[model samples]
Target: MAAGAPRIFVSHLAGVAVFDPNGDQVARVRDLVVMLRVGRRPPRLLGLVAEVATRRRIFLPMTRVTGIQSGQVLTTGVLNVRRFEQRPTERLVFGELLDRRVTLTETGEEVTVLDLSVQQLPARRDWEIDRVFVRKGRGGAFRRSKGETLTVEWSAVTGFSLEEHGQGAENLLATFEQLRPADLANVLHHLSAKRRAEVAAALDDDRLADVLEELPEDDQIEILGKLAEERAADVLEAMDPDDAADLLGELPEQDKERLLSLMKPADAADMRRLMAYEEHTAGGLMTTEPIVLRPDATVADALARIRNPDLSPAHAAQIYVCRPPDETPTGKYLGTVHFQRLLRDPPYTLVGSIIDDDLQPLAPDAALPVVAGFFATYDMVAAPVVDESGSLLGAVTVDDVLDHMLPDDWRETEYDLDGTDDGTDGTADDRRDGTADEGTDERADDGTDGEVRADGA
Candidate 1:
């Protein structure tokens, strides 16, 4: 939904038809999934539980939902047919929250929740429960009684947030909700195995995928091993193709094949293609998904594609201009159009006309050192990898190159806020002591100091 999209009442969404971009009805909304925060803060709208034509209830992540209008929901058409399984941290708005009695913070009066209003946060894709519709005088949601009805902000009521105690994984997740995936992975690394698994299971697939990419190999394998095979496949599918391939390569052949068989055919094919290459080579390190554009695509089109919030900085730094068939393993690789050039050129300019084909692209078999040299010599954040037929395979970003260059234990190494090595094993005690006096400094730097200590403490 857009920033100024009208707020939607949960009651109005119940049983609403869900359509794909083509306007075909695929499912109906059964309930809304939300994650309640630590305090009086608004609960985030996670997604919807939708029942498909086959009567199977599936999870439709809010990210996949393009719009909610005219009493119907529209999706990006990328539906995951897997059954909806509520995580420990997730709450069902219709099934769990509505009709519950909660205390109004100001009046100390108990009101039964009739509905909740969700609004998209300005300039962000996230939606939150911003208002609550309730009735007073001890009336139930269905019961007809003479009670005053009012709408109030989510923060005006109590009892919606998770309790501070006994919500192990849920509370832990809420506390570190704002932490970056890498920082959260670091916290998960120091946790006990059982606790780690609990937290990992509670996380949604997209969140878990991002965190798994940041975790060490052993940790990644361990966490993936604990999830149900179907969910493991889903998480893998959510991950970047290169990262997914790297993780699958670590698994036993049979296990790897099983998960691959479970994934979408196209994603699995990308995984197989990536896994076929040497682990440290350009093909292995490159992500199959890149900003690819046809020769005739305009600068405006390139800018819009790169503006996707999902793209990494490196991936968005430039666009690979190709012949027809823009999806990677794209037709004859034309050239590149750097973002700066796009900005300097008129919106109507064709990317092909301003192409920079001076630098040679990397071959799939290019070794790690060769890939590193390409990035260093050209000062490029990302470089294209093309096959013998001159078709663009994928693009390798500098971060993937750095990940290969660094020691295996690089992620486990402790560092101070100033980027200096702390010279201590990254243990709970070490982390707690490191932040004893420097918590403020760490917070100012990354806003994760208190969260880090909270996890370790």
Candidate 2:
């Protein structure tokens, strides 16, 4: 290590605490951001992506970093609470660069990037990539094992870029991983068909499911059509049944059946139920995975589930209690316990003792309008879905209900040339009204032929 030139591997910085000068912890390093440059120049280190208590990520500029030691980062106490937004030139180091393959020009060997070591450039405030830790050649499996490791100057390796600068698909896939699923789907939507399929093929099942759920029906079908039968089934299995069923509903009957046959029996059965309901109905909007407890479950159990960071806001609002056959929701539906009630009760109190029987659950067959009215009248964010047998089936969240109520073509619409989006929407015939002829020629309702006069004229 060069004296007075402090350096830390990016991997070591993951989750390192960020503290103010007074030693009060503020946040943890979620990721490192960098700016890729042209002509083999090392990407300049931008700053840290700090994750706050709310799990929201914010940018911490490099200038604020006072020290990096004792498994923690010290900041200048100055901070910005705004959420981090990526600039076009910025890339997240861990998400976009680490674990990707790069080639060593001298040995013509490919290696996986394990971590990057960065240090401030001499006589300058700027921090730059100094070296990289790479794992070299095991070459037996899809994910290469770490055989021998070495640290090399950043310039000795290649294949890191934000844009298409003759980089390979692996590099592009790395950048894609950094995008949120919706944004990633938009990128896929614009790609050449062949390239889109290539990118789709590169993603794992869960990632593919997330992206597929965000895409339009046409794009969803196109991507699924290009995937192998088994892979497509896997992707569907990873999706929420409602989303999977909706996508499957768009396929031809034979294709849908074949794909379903390839899926796990339980998942396929759930999809069947979801597909049977009208798309805008309560049954269709509900998810089968809401947290469930039996009557004997204690308040402690409910609080634990609610405390789970992964629970969605609506799902965390209450805990459902049902009768036996609990593995699946095939038992008698008892009632639910709201989160606030859990906090009020003793930890050992049985959930059944304080069940909110006054909270009416939704019937699976309830119409969309009825579901909307139920939520509005009761001020509920989520309602349990029960079947005619009085068995717990699922819980319909307000988000799903509201989403189903949106215009079918909402995702397809775009802002107009004047930066305004609302209008008499254009139709398939490229006319505001479907009855108009498809011609670009402008006509006017003037007394004279061939022109529309200005309002004043």
Candidate 3:
């Protein structure tokens, strides 16, 4: 649903048909999975438990859902066929919350939950339970017997959140909800193997995909191996194509093939194409998804695309002007329009008119040193990689180049907020190197530069 759309009551969604982009019915929603917070904070609406034609229930993550309107749920056409398993952190809205008694903070009167309303947070994809529909007197959801009924803000009720003493991965995650993916990856790296797996399993696919991209190669392989193959594929699909390809390339041939087969054909093809390149080449380092504008696109169009919150700073630094086919391996390489140039132009000015074609584009097979040199010489955060045929392939971001150049264990190193080394050796082999006890905190010193540092524990 779009941000600021009308709230959807949970009761209305029961058994609603779910369709793919093609409008073919895929399943019917059986329940909604939510995670309760620590206080009266509204619970996050996770996703849906949907039943297919086979009567088997599966988990449909919200990230895959594109629309929920006209009594139908729309999906991205990518579904993980594995049966849904309830995690410790999840609560079924229909199964566990309805008809339950919760006390109102004002009157100290108990009310029975009849229905709940969920609203998508503005400017973000996350949805949360925002209002409670309840009866003032005792009555079951089916029973007509009831006193005054009314809808109240979620914070008016007092029985939903987890207990203060509760011990679980969910609590740990909530406590560190603000941590960057790299910092969280560091915490997970120092955790016991069992704890790491538990936390990984509890995280939603999108968040897990982000954290996995920052984790060490061994950690990434181990965590991916432990997940169900169907879910592994889903997480892989959620990741950036280049990172996904790199991870898949590390797997055994049979295992890699199996995961690739489970993914959507288009995504799988991107993986295959990326994996075909040498690990350190431009083709391997470049992200298939970038802001590609056609020759006729206006500065307004390019600016709007660059404004997408999902785009990394590096990717948004410029727009690649191409031919008719705008997708990567586009019709023909035109020229680039830097972000600064877009700002200087009129809103309706054509991007193609002001393109900077003086600098040559990097070749797909450009070596790591050559690619790095291009960035250093031009002082560019990103550069386009074009094939010999003059078709725009993809753009190599400087961060990816740095990730490849850094020591294999650089992610494991510990540095203080002031950019100085701590007294202890910067290694994670001990599994307790820089944790809460050491008063250490990790922060992204420079997100575009891919620099992270510890903040005095």
Candidate 4:
């Protein structure tokens, strides 16, 4: 058992009805939720949610629950769980902690909260929370607030329940709904390659696409390498077609063809056409998902078209200004204005004038280095990709490039090769000179011994 955790059987609490301070019966113990942590897995409690029949299912922070004997939790008092509401920022399992303060080491001008330490206290027969104590970097002595204490206000303490001592891929899998894809991607970066693959395999296709979009190109390739071809293809298909096309383009030529073949015909055709252009220029980085309106369409019609469920945000960056169907192949790019810009302007205002001529557009054959540099030069989150005819092709986003180039591990490496008896170091001679060490393999290169010879007779 963990030093501080108590193991109580669930059978004890099954029949007991829970009550508030007023003695009104709430919900009965329906189930016990226990994650295997360290030693002796103890069962934890998960209260039911509030509904019309149950009225309100309030949370009981672990702190207020004084003891867990038999199966029932012994409370400090008959207080209604409702009285103590969970702060929005509080972590689950851990109690409410919002503005709690802690002293942390001040290396230079910056300050940080020290992480919690897990250790056993022999005298108390329980675990002690050893927090890191820190202050300003200046030496000597500093002014004290109530005589120098490293304590944090109880309010700032959020969830600290280590579901398990070891890393939990399943926990991460279960909490998929609670985190952003970018945060999941960041967490995945810390895991081993195999562990990361497991996490990827566990997610649904839509979620996998989201997480993939957040990962760097190298990490994307690595995770994809570990997955079954069918699974990988399914996830790619779930992604925005243009995003999928961009990622597929980054794959090795052989992999690119294999994956493309596995994709649906429509998706495959879109990717194939996108692949035909140079990668760095507008052709290579542009997304084919764009919302274009026929020049003759009314603003109401355009708004109606935009409301269609089939169109995604990626395809509908406001509306792409285009010429009528009868117009020549070259046509014209009247102007590109955002949805907000159009909505705010007078209804009669032509989109051409409203469109920002300062719009950044790139050619398909343009080099990627140049394109990347242009994104930096312009500080643009998105840039348009176009063909020689000035028709819109696709758009590239800064997130895609970030996922391409960001580093995985950010910690500094510590290496020390001090003393050794290996031949690489001269210390081997000193250790062997005085006496032969038992079990040492002392053998000559030519033979075990020069004196040992065979006679032919």
Candidate 5:
């Protein structure tokens, strides 16, 4: 190939041997993995790929590969085989955790494989193996098998070097570790509802709870229905009480009753109480768990309490400036202090001074429409849900409001410019009938049509 000339498709580079400058076959091209450019640009090359023998596929930078020719392609720089690790692709199985497979990487001794997560990102057709986590190991073949596990982060993938793994594999597959609940939820939302249910079904109860808490109420219901009732009950138990209530509220009457009956009595009671309140109302929306501190508690003490897992995520975000231990918090529900602000502000500053009077809160029984409007008006991501007595409840995030505010087909219609008018009139008929105005075309003045009417008049 001539210098600076674009490389033409040199026969699908699958299974071709990738050679370093030294002529040793360093790795095999598994697949031609293309990394699409993100943001405003369409998909562009991030790099090429070659899978070395092992669990990991090595990343060959686009600039490094000198030529693509018949039978084999050549990579310019001397290859260091010790860089990328190899392992089996992570797979999701029912009743199992994603981070079970611990694999040996080139650099790290051993890392936990969290998920075999796949993400087809926005504005791109191909799925990108987004991240590989090496957080920890619980159980898997590694638990009994003899080998060390190492960690390989998504950031560590230098580039993808393509190889033909088999004779006629139809699709390209990249193995990845398990994803966090938040990540799983985001991925599921991008997929079809049916597929979302399938993926959810594969998660164990604990993992399911994590994923469920992250999903929208509608999705949560659909996924719960797909799970066995006993399994669903177990998942509900693992979820935050407020989140569990939210899901239960969306379930069919019969299913809801069955799941709740299966739930532990204590958890069931809490959910029942929360469910009794209207969905949009403060009571319905409020999280029962909050880190309550008496007005007298020191700022240090308040910070310590904020770390408590017992406190809901919503509660942790806002430290309630209230009378502690009393269920009946007085009109004394003066204001709120953000945990971030609390940490940065002077410790000696009384909680009263730190309390933001502007803290917007909603009362239980407050209409959904009203609360929805409040979120918009305030530009609030989340707001405290409160009761008639001004007691703390759960919080509502702007994300929670999105499904309600958007039309059912919003996602389908959002990027749909296919049927849009191209700034021209509707159709040929419409243009002809003058319903749509085509610009007036004035004939050029050639002076050929000039006629003189004798001024007989």
Candidate 6:
């Protein structure tokens, strides 16, 4: 940037609250609009895309912006409530700029765009990109230089510099890669169909699986169908088995079989085992990756396993004590020890000594209400699922149970965008499975062995 050029980071300007001179808050800036220019000239600032109440996004022309400062954007005129649509020549600073690959003028080596600082002109009528923050340039197999950083004027770079048909689309995906799966999924859900598919295609299998699990069943199927068959199978294997099975159940029998055939033999076996349960059964809602251990395991061993950061809160609450340790069919399901027991018992105490058998383990075919009632009756967070052969199968987590307890079309409900429920009741489906928990895909948790059970009941 030119010496002492008044500059504000592009990130600072984004999401700033815009107000009128009369002091009435208008909308928040969702992104900055810029128009690409010919060789050597920087992309010119167009306007601001702001989102207001009532869930509408409108355009605020830069000319109307009276003042720009940290945390506040003052406008001299009215904001047109017209939806902001991207023109052929325009690009978004956040959506299209940040995280893009740009070639440094000094090094001629491609570096990653981390952040940009925009400077208002001396005339105060125009704004231009000023300083850029870059990391080590691109090298081997998507690997970037570590601890490498550079700050330079916007004039020092080139990339996403042209107004082409598909300019910045891939950069958009790169920008999203920094977000958590749930956050990325939220962005994907709001995007246009073509854009969503493009972004989905760019994500790796595990990440796509994570995002897909957070999406509604219909959206999951739609996105999966767009992927190559082998890729789709890989993604399914990456997802939690129960979630993968839930999605496969929605597909046609032929389509389901085709995808299953493409999966690894072990993964396919697990999928088939999970798919065997009815959607509302306790077995249907359980995740097979529960913490299972031999009866001889010590509390210290149990504690170490739960310490794994990736274990969802529900799964870590209890330990299933079995005769043999293969969790695939947790052999001879002896009993369960709640997390609280591990904390209370001595480190060297055998898990078998603390097994809590107060609550009954659910059969694979237990109906939804039975599972829900089991949770409510025992006030539990998770319960073990065992087969008729007395082999430990999996644990029914509270989150999965609660999701099933909600209406089948819960995602379509008019609650908050962040997925918070608004206390409104929803319509129910038919498929009664004995208890009232009928057609819902809810799951549940139940019983422990000791008095101070991990209480993930």
User: What are the per-model numbers of colliding residue pairs?
Assistant: 0, 2, 4, 14, 40, 18
Candidate 4 has its poorest 10 consecutive residues by lDDT at 448-457
For residues 154-272, write the lDDT of model 4, one tens digit per residue.
12232233222222233234333455676567546544575577567667788888888767677888998887888888888887665677788778899988987888887787778
Cα lDDT tens digits for candidate 1, 231-259: 99999999999999999999999999999
Q: Per-residue alpha-carbon lDDT of model 5 for 215-305, expressed as tens digits?
A: 7666777788877888889999989776788888777789889899999997888899889976656566555655555666567777777
lDDT of each model, Cα atoms only? 0.79, 0.73, 0.78, 0.47, 0.51, 0.72
Q: Which stretches of candidate 5 lie over 4 Å from their true place?
A: 1-183, 186-204, 214-219, 226-228, 305-315, 326-332, 348-353, 357-360, 376-379, 408-457
Q: Which stretches of candidate 3 lie over 4 Å from their true place?
A: 1-168, 415-421, 425-457
lDDT of 4 at 224: 85
Candidates ranked, most accurate by lDDT first: 1, 3, 2, 6, 5, 4
Q: Residue 254 in candidate 3 has what lDDT?
A: 100
List the candidate 6 regions with Cα displacement exceeding 4 Å.
Answer: 1-6, 9-91, 97-115, 120-179, 407-457
Q: Give the deviation of candidate 1 from the true structure as CA RMSD.
A: 17.1
Give me candidate 2's TM-score against the actual structure: 0.59
lDDT of 3 by residue, 106-159 (tens): 999987777889988998877889999888876532235549999999999887
Off by over 4 Å in 1: 1-168, 415-457
lDDT tens string, model 6, 1-457? Answer: 2334567777666557887766777567767877666666666676777765434455566666677865798876454443455665567787667656678777688777767777777744666676888777453212335748888877888776633222224445544455656556655665656556666776778888989987878789889999899999999999989999999999999999999999999889888999888988999999888898898889999999999986777889998998875666777998889998899999999999899977779999999999999998898999999999999888898888888989886643433443433222331111112221223221111111111101111
Q: lDDT of model 1 at residue 213?
A: 98
Identify the superior model by TM-score, candidate 1 or candidate 6: 6
lDDT of 6 at 208: 86
- Candidate 4 similarity to native, TM-score: 0.48
Better of 1 and 2 by lDDT: 1
Tell me each candidate's TM-score.
0.58, 0.59, 0.58, 0.48, 0.49, 0.67
